[model samples]
Structure formats: structure tokens, C-alpha cells
Target chain A: MIAALMTKKEWITNNVRRKNLGAHVLGVTAFAGGHIAVHWLMPSGQVVQDNWDMHGLEFPSLTVELPEMAWDEREIHDVFGYRPQGHPDLRALVRNPRWPDEFYPMAGLNAPQKPPWREVAPNNPEQTVEGEGVTIMKVGPTHAGIIESGHFVFSIIGENILHLDLHLFQNHRGVEGQLQGRLIGSVAPLISRICGADTVSHQTNLAMAVEEMAGYQVPDEIKWQRILLLESERILSHLNDLAQIPAGVGFSVANQKALTMKERWQRGLTVIFGHRLLFDTVHPGKSLAMDTAALGALITQLQREWRPWRSLVQGHHGFQDRMKGVGMVRQSDALRFGGQGVVARASGLTFDARQLMPLYHGWHVDYASETSGDVSGRFKVRLDEVEASWRLMQGVLQRYQIHSALPFWEPPTDLIGQAATFSESPHGLNAHIVAVDRGKVIRYHVRSGTFRNWPLLSKAVAGNAVGDFPLINKSFELCYSCLDR
Target chain B: MGKSIQVLQLRHVDAGSCNGCEQELTALGNRFYDMQHSGIDVVASPRHADGLVVTGPVTDTMKRPLMQDWDAVPEPKWLIALGDCAAGCGVFQGAYACYSGVASVRPPDLVIMGCPPLPQDILRQITVWRKTLD
Candidate 1:
């Protein structure tokens, strides 16, 4: 980890636009005392962190050089009132019309002033494509079924789609704003709520980041337990995605079969770990450790449950016909958009956080990549990952022999610096940046896999049939709550 | 209005939920819970629904829509708050984005509590509601 203090202009010119750069921007965060930090990850797991001291809310934007920085910059603007001078699109990202114009929530700029009660626009209007018979169909903010609300406006002619304008943040809850001044230890439960499906990953990422801040390390047994929790989360989330795919194509039987397996898997997790979703199960330097016997039984149960569904789903031709060659994300586009996890892997980009980070070094998990970059590709990647997670759990259980749970390591109260960490979430790479001052959190930023992958969704859905939107969307499984948070 | 209804059509409104409640709600329809067997059907629109199965703490952005949907529900419709968030904002209470649960918008006939109540819990609540009506 390398942290450098540079001028905003120098930082942008030197690092943001530099050719032959090996790092990807994790996120841009803002601190109370005029500090702007950009967390980046080099190809070799090394974090190249840069902090610029700004007098006020003005800073040089990196959007021109790296388009992916646009969302982060906009969020920074919304949260901290940081004016990104050169940002191409400086529209309100998360701050809705309900929020007062000058009040910034994250920085706590205007605490005494309550935002006035007024009627506000429900969502931002989409940029429509103008042409003859180019009708637009808008879906969600409040969707059918139990899915997260995200408004997608599809400009279509007949059944073919021309462009999909996505408007997320309808569920934005100002999660970062709420985390301020809390003890580092108390933030896990709140972090878990950032996204429900990937609760373990969110907690692990936040936990790992806070632990890094305090310079603490867990015992091997606890480390394995954390990995076990993470892998279990991955398996269940991927299974959820798998079920969605079959359901998307009207294959209800296959869908139910997979969902039943997932339920059984989750039930086993609940029996062993005490929480079906495993919320608050992981904390800094420790996790809710499972007994070796229960874990073994869970693994055996999973093996028995997964085999039949895996065989049937993989062999089914109708499911394949619907999933294959649909929602294709090109290699160049994936790279350009900074795609991570299944979205990138399916596009043949071998960019998994586990492969890069030291935390997951000992875990013998296989990286699943498919060059097709289609719905089938993403589906196949998720299926392979579920199997890989199952294998990893089996491996961890075999190697670690312990009768009781590992003892928790206490975090030092004296924390003064920033710590950034990333984890392979079920959807993609989940990155968290934490800034602490004297034991209390000053700045906390969580960039979920959905945040990174949502951009790719708009790109991927283009040129596909209007009816294929659900299938394409289900394949991505991007959570609006995570993105909104 | 007084007639005993056979099929209960539920329209789910996500009033700033954490997706946890939504997950459990989705699971209720799966083979394990099989909510359809009990005559609870999740319709696409509130116009065609008998009740509103709501989730999340009513956020500023979603409050208007939630109220609009509530008004859209026909006479003799039930409003069931699905999780702690909807029941009373759960942990997300007092946050800037939240309006302190769906009860703030309109008091629910039934409130299912849990950070996110399980599918079985939801099924049990629906069954209880069914029994009371019968």
C-alpha cells in the first residue's frame, strides 16, 4: 500500500490519464478536513492510494481521462459537495430533488437545517431516442415480483431495442452518511444491510478494511472460517441467479428445483451458522465460526443436493437456447467499463479479487472465465463458482481440525489512518475504503459489485429484443439496493 | 366487501427496502413454501390485487409511489408490511433517506418483523390472516 499527498491537478495529470497504467480506480472518497482520496488497485494487488488536500469542495475531475470515474466523482459531488470541474456529466447521482440544493449529507455540512417538505420528481427523465415509431417502455422503481426497484427505459421499435436508459438510486438510503462517528466494531451490522444477498462479502470487506486500519490479523482458524462464510454466500447468491435464469425463460420446474436446492443449502447454513443470511457473522479479526462436524454434514448435504440439479440444468437444451448468446458483453467493452467478478470473467477478463489479494492466497479456488460473454457465459461462470465454493468449503473443512470456535482478536482503539480493501463478492469485486481518526470512523465508502456492473447492464442490454430484457437482467443479477447504497 | 375471498392477490411495494425482505418474499413462492398452494398470488399490478405486500422503510423517494399504490388498491384490500423495515424501519430508522417504516405512510393490517422475516414466517403470517378471514 502506497499513500501519496499530491495537488488535485498534479494527481489527475500524473495518474488518471497516464498510459500503460496497471491500476484500476476502486473509488474516490472524501474526508471532513478537506481531504480527497482515490483508492486504486495495481495488477499485483498493491493499492496505489492518493489523497489531495482541497480548500473547499472543488477538485480536478478524472472523468475525461477515465470515464469510469464519472459515477464516483458524481457521488463525491453529491455526498461531500465536491465540484468536479471537468466532469462531462455533473448531474445529481444519488442526491435526489428532495434533498436541498446546498445541503450535503455525507460531509454533514448543514446539520441544523432540515430539508423543506416539497413535492419532488419521482425519478430523473431518460434521454429518449427520437425516431419514427420508436416507442419507449419504462419498467420499475417499483417492479413486479420481489425484485429490487430500478427504473429501466427501453427505446424500442417493434420488439428490437435501440437503447436502454437506466435510472437507479430509487432505493438510496444514504448508508455512508449514517456510518459516521460510529465505533469501528459497531459498523458491521450496518455494513451487512448495504446489500442483503452478499451480506458476508460486504461484512468481510468492511471487516478486512477496518482490521487493516488497526493493523490487526486473525488466527488461521478464524481466517478459514471467514472464507467458509464468504464461499457459502457466493454459493447461495449464485444459486439465486441460476434460479432466476430458468424462471426468466419460463422454465418453472428447473427454477423451483434450483431454488429448493438453494433453500436446503441456506437451511444448512442457518442450522450451522445460526443465521440464514449470515449477517453480523463476520467481524474484524474474527467470524462466527462453525463446528467442523456441522460443516462436514452441510458439505455432504450440499453434495447430495447439488448433483441432480447440476446435471439436469446443464443438460437442458431449452434453458441453453434462451441463455446462450443473450446479453453479450464484449471483451473491450467490459475492460473499458471496469467490469469485475462474473461480468468481467464471462467476458474472458481474468480479474477476480481473490486471485489478487493476499487474504485469499491459501484458498485453492478455481477462476471461471468464458470468452462468449453471453447470458450462458455468465450462467456457466456462476455455476462453476458455486461448485468451486463447494470444493473450497470441503477443502477448508478437511484441512482445519478444531472442536471449538476460534477466539476473537480485539482491535486496537488507537486508529488514525485510512484502510482500503476489496473482496470477490458474489456479483463482482466489492471494494470498501475506510478513514478513521482516533477510533471513530470519519469516512466510510462501500462500492458494491452492483455499482460497477450496472453500467455494463445498460451497455449489454442494447440491441437485444425488448422481451429479452428480463433474461439479460436476471443473468447479471445486479442489486439496486447495493447500487443505491 | 363482506364476502369471503378465495384467492388473495398480493402486490409487493418496495418502499426503500434492503432487498432482504424481498428475497424471503420471493422464496415464499418457491417449491419449499409454495405460497400459490395456499391461494396467495402475487399479481403484477396493484389494480388487479387484493392486498399490498410492502417491504422497506418508506424512503422520501418511494413514499409518494407507495401512497399512490396504496390508493390504487381496490376496496377491501389489505396492507401487509413484510419486514421490520416496513413494520417500523428496523435498523435503518432515523436515517436521512428513510421515513421510519411503511407504517408512517399508512398503518399496515399485519406487520411481519425480522431484519428480514423468513419465508416460513411470511407464509405463517399469511395463513393466520387467511384463518381470521375465514
Candidate 2:
């Protein structure tokens, strides 16, 4: 259904009271046309949409009732110069003083009067720990490992963390702004790079959204091929996450083993697709070149190799000891904050988009969930998802025939309109919203799983030690590029 | 060829990378490549390192921190720019938040080019550097 626009006050009053509509805020996105689109992810996983037209630069904020709206609203303020009136903490999110507060990248305005760029004082919150032994520690923007930029400030008394604050967006590259006004066919590469590790997921989700907008129906053969690609991507990403847990615990043997499997899986991708990370492998109305025989062999190899390696990692007592109870995120907290993927599943919320949405091509997946709400529970969920992905891949290979020929779809000319799609990314639910006009993208917004789950990290590490932070952080295995973009 | 160090202790810096390079770096340490076997190690701190293995276009916010990391490594340390992002800013070139490439901060001693260079390619590059010591 097309989303209807309402005056800011009316939309809030009607939605906040859940008046005649059982809807929850899925996400809110701002565009260059000077409007905010609010999506409601209903209980049945169908998205109901609405818009708030900001006549001026200010609009009533919905964050008072929905704490999750804080980030969404602040992002709009940063990029579009639209203010969410009554927002608790409206600071520069994606932009710092280096870009000048007046210069909104996506506002797309003509040259106007502006002051010279200058470094602003860091807007980080002052430490509030009032006790005698409390101390503050800061990490990252550049961490010890091969990771992206983000700052975590921990207020601790000895080893127990009293409070933690996450300051992300240090790596923002104006990705969304870059997509604005580009041809629909051209943005796929940019979307793929939004997060390299999950390139397939981003590309597939964007393709689905574009296809929907253009009213193109993929052929059955290509549909099955896309499913195979999706499941392959999921299995490989889960394996990578599974390895991180062991590596964080200092179990080099298990870490090396799991990583080797991940490497082999990626090498298989490179052999078939010509890129280890599958860059530009999937595009709107098209699938990149693939050799059926190589794909079949790779799937078979993954199916055979994964079982014993999974057992080896899970059966280790020392690994279990480090993960069992560390970084516990309560079920209630996860739900309240709109957590998705591993963060939500481990806390006993079983909301996988593949099962709930129509994007899975009618295949029902049996996803796993654990109520333990700890690091071990998250690992268990990853293992279960990996197995499920493996079964799906095996099923695809089993159905393929050597003599069969599959056709790829071509993009339609004169494509126009808007579309929003969600898929079960390895991290969680990933949403891509696009608006097209005259075959050009006017606006694009990505609500990745990492953005949803990042808030949960601070809450999870509330009482954990500083040393345990890496293990806890790795369990979620978030993609900083996805979050930063 | 005989004047090279046997061990290359490196520190990774992510200025503004998409993390494609970081994944390859992790794979380099896996059983397939096993970087430690070649006497190449990734250290946690720059103070204990002989070089900085950098990724991504250096962003305005990360410029100070990246340079501080580079300065922390003692003399005779090398600067290796990994991936197209580090070499020429890749897709994020001319971005308002970035300085384009690592060369804007300092000339790189070695530049490995790819959207994200394959793990084997990275390992091979290091291996060739190791062979120069013979």
C-alpha cells in the first residue's frame, strides 16, 4: 500500500496511541525533497508507511514515546537541516564541525553564504560516574584489530563497567548523498560497498526493491538462483562470525580452523564470480556471471566440510567458559530497542525476515532462537542459522539439473517510482528504501541490521569487564561500514 | 636484498575503509595463509610496531588519529597502503568527510591495489618482501 502523508501532530497522536492501527515504527528516513517518511513494521511483518511534510525546518518529534527514533531523527537533522522539535539530544551525527553545521550535504541547495571550516570541540558526553573509584576509558575510531572506526567510552569502577557510550559515524562517507540523483542502474556498486562483508545481501535487497518499483517479475530459474546466492552469502557470513568468537577468546586453533573454512568459502566465490567479496555480483534485474558446475561443487564441498568444524568449535570447554554468561542482553531490553538478527534471536525474539517477509520465494526456513540472552546464546543462534543456510544451499544443488538452462533478467526501460524492501541479512533485518523519478534515483536510505543492534551493545556491556568487551563485541559481529554508511 | 628485516611487525589503521581490506587481512592470518609462518605479525599497539598497514581514504575526522598512529611507530618503519581506497580513495573519492587517499598525509612505501586485494595477493606481496632479505 502507498504511504499517506499526515501533518506532524496528527501522525504522532494517531500512531503513538496505536489508534485503530496496530503498528510499530519500523524506521524513519528523510529525503532531499524536504520530507520524512516513517515506516511501521507491523506485527505480521508487513510495512505500513506514512510521511510527515515539514513545511519549515522544524517538526514535532516522535522520540518521546519511541526512544529508537532518536537516531533516526538526529540523522535527518544532520543531513537535511530538518529539526525534530523536542528531541532529547540532537547533536551532529554523521557530520562534524569540519564540514560546517550549516552545510547539509543532501540538502542539495545552491551555493550560499558560509563560514570557513574549523574543528569543533568534541561533542562527546562528559563522564557522569560520581563514585570515588570510578574511571573513564576510551577506545577506537582506530582500534587494535582490522576494524572500522567507532568510539566506545566506558565508565567503570575497577573491572565492572558502570556505563558505556557508543560514538559511531566516524567513517561516514556521505554514501546516501552520493546516491541521490544517480541513475538507478549505477548505484548497485555503491550499495555493495556500503558493507563489503555483506555485499550480496545489500545488492540482493536493492535489486528486489528496484524490481518491485519497476514492476519486473524475475523468471523462476533466476529466482531460484538468487535464493542460492542469498543462502550462500548467509552461510559464509555466519561462519565468519562464528570464527570471531573463538578468536576473541584467544583460541587460535579454533579461530584458525573456522577462518580457514570462511576463506575456502570465499575462494569458491572468487573462482565463480571473479571477486572474493562478490563486488557488483548482483545488480538490478540481473545476476553476475556464474558457472553452474563450479557453484555445484562449491555447495557440495561446504555441505560436507561445515558439520565437523562446527562440532569442533562448539565442543570446546574453554571457548564455552569465556562465552557462556558474558555480555548478557536482557530479552526485554532487546525488544524495547528494536534489536534484530543475532542480538534479537539470542534474546529469544524469533523475527527473521526470511520467514516473515515474502522475499524468500515461498521457502520456509526454520530459524533458531535462545532465551539465554548471553554471548553463548548468540553463538548458538549463529550455528543454527549456518546449518539452516547449508540445508537451503544443499536443497538448491539437489534440484539443479545438468542439462537445464537458466535465463537472467534484463532491466526495463522507463522505470520510475519508489520501493522499500527488507531481507534477513546475516547481522539481522536489512532495509533498503529508494525513490525513483525519470529512471534516476532521487533518494536512497539503508537501515542496516548493524544500526538496529548497535544500541544493544552498550546495554549488554553494562556490567562486563573491559577485557570481556572484545568477546562480547565480536559475538554480535556488526559491520561498521554498514552502520557508518 | 640482504638488508631487509626478517620479521615485519605491523599495525592496521582503518582511516575510512569499507572494511573489505580488513576481512582480507583477517584471512591472511587464517590457516590457508598463516602470516605468522612468514614472521609477519599484526600487533595491537603502534608503539611496538615497525610499520602501519593502512586501509580506506583518510577521512577528515580520522586524519589526526591516523597521523598520530603513523608517528607512534619508531624510525625505519614503513607505511603500506592497502586497497584502492587507501591508494586513490576508491569510491569515496572527493567526499567531504575524507582527505581522498593516504598519500595526502604521507607517501606510502608500498601500495597494494584492489577494491580489496585478495588474501593470497596480500600474503604474496609480504612473501616477496621477505624474499628480498635473502
Candidate 3:
């Protein structure tokens, strides 16, 4: 049965190949097949087509059929080093054991067999001068401040960082692979867990994906509510960051002030939204439980409390001294690596998904960016963002009061379709792609803002002294489990 | 230049924990209960730390790293067991990787109980540590 399905898939793929039409091949198996499934995509946009087999096999295997004429045998050999026996090009191959078979699993019979392992040839090692006092300082995976776990091996020559290699992934949660076949509604909680600091942002992206998949247009009132919650998330996170910077520099008074303000913000969230972090507040196919009058009251309360605190923190000279130029990220770096949120905005890269691609279609939002890529830049960007969010929240509240009936749409009951959605999260622009089959999420791809900033973070730390690592890391504040997953 | 108190912090390791104690430890630096204002800071490297703040239940894999962290910190440092988990392994005592608490790895100078004590509670313990230092 397995062989029969593979042959049918191959035949279909070959026929499509002759017509220059793109085709996707998918395989699903039960019980004895070890529950292995394969999903293949062509250049043309098409939902993964499945070929099922019910065969008694010890291990599960899935294969994708490719056209022989159009196949790149040389590229395959370079990547996997397994050349098909009857393939056109078999000479340009490098045999290796570390080839990726786990990610792209293919059938063994039609595929090329594994080549012989090549012996690792040793290169001449570089000579090192014997130094009297050289200490290897390792900091990582666990540390002080609001930074995630990652190992940094610093070969220091008396306080100067001579060589540094960052080894991360202490908080790997495998969230991406876990999203496969999960119902669209079920993905919110999983997205929320991506990063505690940016919980609302991740969930918003997931919610947007679901909304898009279902062709459901969110009510204007709910949209405003989402913006309010998103701003609240920003205020809390920025306050937390601001508080940590002062604490790092041993400024007790400043740290205390920031912390207190942050607590107040959290408390307000709890009072208004029923949760401090607003976890599970805005979900797919659900309206915000809070009333318009209550939301307006909360907004008034927040405005009264936040204005003075913001002014006090901004006016502090000592805090400014510690923050300004502490960790500078250049605009070039930000643009090249696709840095997101405050990190990208601080470096003068103006890219906010809300302004760029407004999901609700007609909503207007105020966006801000900064030029200085230092700690001060990040602080300023976050500060400005807080203000912008506050303004947006107010706008949303006013709109909600005026617009009595908000439109809510439901998901289209169709199988084999794709939908993509983008939302402005606390971190940055979060994009989620949903492939659905009859209202169930067949596969979900979440490209979080944090994931986009990982490479930039590693680059930011490079060339800076070892002492500034903690401060630099805090400035970027990339989520570990979010990226790891 | 003047007489200064040297602080060396030891970060405890746990295989799996609820993170309640960690939150409390983090809260110590917040506005409500400012530990840094009291001259107490959470250091990343154990070598330069003056105290060890152990939270959560001990696990088999975490045993070596926890011991290594403890050993790495200089002598004349204090060990504090924070939370019920650190005091007696709490809810994860009989779980697969979890063994016990700070006692399983090293002797603790102080044991503060609660699933996770409040920031004020953490502040009170720090005050006690300062008094002991004097």
C-alpha cells in the first residue's frame, strides 16, 4: 500500500512537471508506520496534498516525488551526498554523515543510498604564545539581569576580550514543530508561552493568523481592545527594562521608582483585564470581556499615573548617563539583519507592521523611531513607543465608544487553503502562516519578532568588551525559548 | 577607597521548577522591595559573589553544576535557601530528576519558607544577612 501511494504521487508529480504546473506531495500513515508524515511544497502556492498508506512497517518513512528532468542532482549530492543511481550528475558529491535527513526525510528505495564516510583531514594548528596570566571566563545559560540563557566563552587578556564565542540554546522549547496540525484556536496559548515578557505580542500574531485563516474580520471595538492590551504590554516591558538598567548600575532609587511604576501598570492590567500580563485576554473567535466605559476609566487612570512617572524617569541625569551610549547598534546592522521592535527602531530602521500592513484595514496608529543605537536609543524608542501606544489606546477607546456595533467574521469552512496574518506585537511585527483543512490548522508557521532579532543580537555583542556583555544583552532582550522553538 | 562589603552571588540550579521562587527573587529588585537599595545585588558569576541564593528543588543533572557553582564562589560566602522548593524540594520532590533542595547539594546558612516568599520576605532575609556581615 505504501509503495502504491508513492507510485501514484510520483505519477502525479511527473504529469504536473510536463505541464510546468507546481505540485505538493504529502504522506500520512497510521500505527505501524510509526506515524511518520511528509509535507512537500512546490514553487507555486498550494496546500500540502497527502498520500496515505496503511502498511505494517517497523519504522516510519515518507517520500516526496521530484521530476527527474527538473531535479538538481548535483545540489542534492552537495547537501545530502546521496546520488540517485540513475541520476544525471553523480560526480560532484561530498559524502558526509552530518547531512540533514531528519528535517527532509525521503524514501530509501527511490532515493540515492548514503555514500561512504570521508576521513576528517587535520589542518595545521595555529601556534599560540604562552601567556603567564590568561583566564577563561565562562558566563551563560544562567545569569544576572533580564537576559536569556546562552554560554559566552571569553578568553580574556587582563580584562580585554581577546576571543569570544557565544553558545546559546539553554531554553529550547521546540514550539514551531509543535504547532503542526494544532487547531487554530489552540495555538494562542502556545504563542503566549513563547516569551513571558512578550506574551501578548506572540498571541496577537497567532490570533491574527487564525482570523485570517477563518476570513474572520475582528470587531472594531475588539481591535481597539487589542491595541490597548498591546500598549499595556509595551508599558510593562519597557518599565521592567528601565528598572533593570538602573539596578545593573547600582542606582537603587531609580530602580525602585521604575519597579514601582511597573507594578502599578501591572496592577492596573489586573484590575481592568483580570490578569496582570493580559494572558489569554484577546483570542481567536472571542470578544474582549471588558466594557467600553470600564476601558475608558482604566485609560484615564493610567494617564494620570503614568505621566508623572515618565517625566521623573526621563529627567534623571544619573539614569541617562548610565543608559546613553552604553550599547550602540548601528542602522546598517539593524537593516541587514532585520532587527525588530525597539531594537530596530532605536537604530533608525522604521519598520512597524501596524503602520506598514494594518490588519484591520482602516485603523490609523502613531509610530515613532530613534537614531541612536545605544542603550539610550533603546530607552528612547521604548519610551516613545509607550507614549504612542497610550495615544493609540485612547484613540481606540474613543472609537469603541462611538462605534456601537463592531463586525465579527467567522472562518471559511474550506479544506486545503493557506492564510497569512501580521500583527504589531510588543516585541515587533509578528507574522504567522496558517495552512488549514476544513477549519483545523494542518500546519502553522510562526515567524516571531524575536526570531528575526537573534542574529542581530549576536552581531551586536561582537567587538564590545566583556564587561558590557550583560548590558548589551539586556538592551537587545531577545527571547530564548521563542527563538529556540 | 573606604571599607566596602564584597558581594559574591551563587545562582542555584534545578532540573525543573515552577519558577515561582525565581519570580520572588526577581521581585527583590523591583520598586516594592528594592534589594539593590539595601546594597544587595544578584551577581551572574559565582566567583565574585558573596552569597548563594538557592531556589527550587535539586535535580540529578543540576547536582554537578550546582555544586560547581557553589565551589566556584569564594569562601566566607553565605548560602540562602529560598522558597519551599529550596527548603524541602516542595512539590517536585518525588519527580524524576528532582532530588531534594539546597541541602542535597550544599549546607545553607539560611532557609526561608513559602511556595515563594514575597519581596518583603526576601528583603527581611537580606537585612539579616547584612546584620550577620557586620
Q: A1-485 in candidate 1: lDDT tens per residue?
A: 24565666688776664323757677777776566777788887888767777766688888787777778888888877878888998787787777877777776632222356357776665777989999988887777777777777889998888898877788877677777777776777788888888888888888788778777777777778888888989988998999999889898888988888888888888888888777778878765546778878877887887888888888988888888888999998887778878999999988788888776787787889999999999999998898888888889888876546666578877678877888888988888888787778777888887787888888898889988988998999988887887
State how far residue A53 of model 3 sits from its true place (Å): 22
Regions of model 3 farther than 4 Å from truth: A1-136, A145-147, A155-164, A291-313, A402-416, A438-442, B1-25, B33-134
Global Cα lDDT for candidate 2 = 0.79
Stretches > 4 Å off in candidate 1: A1-9, A17-19, A109-114, A403-408
Best by DockQ: 1
Tell me the tens digit of each residue's lDDT in model 3 across A1-485. Answer: 24344554454454345224432221121111222323333333233333334233222121123322112233233332333334433432111222233322122212122222123321112222246676677764455542344456666666655555544333322234344445555556556655556677767766666676556677666666777777788777777777666666676776677677777776667777876556667776556667667666765776686678677767988778877776667887675444678888889877676664454346666677889888878877877777777777777677665356545555444534665555566667565555666656555545567665665665665556667766676676665544443
List, residue by residue over A283-389, the lDDT tens digit for candidate 2.
Answer: 66665556777887887787677778777877888888888889999988887777888899999888777875665656757789999999999999988888888
Pitting candidate 2 against candidate 3, the one with the higher lDDT is: 2
Cα RMSD, model 3: 10.7
| Best-matching candidate per lDDT | 1
Give the TM-score (vs. native) of candidate 1. 0.95
TM-score of candidate 2 on Cα atoms, chains taken together: 0.93
Candidate number that wins on DockQ, 1 or 2: 1
Residue pairs with clashing backbones, model 1: none
Reference-based lDDT, residue A63, model 2? 81
Task: Predict model 3's lDDT versus the native.
Answer: 0.57
By TM-score, is 1 or 3 better? 1
lDDT of 2 by residue, B1-134 (tens): 33367678999999888888998898888878888898888999998888999998887677877888999998778888999989984987766666668999999878889889887788888778656446
Model 3 chain A TM-score equals 0.70
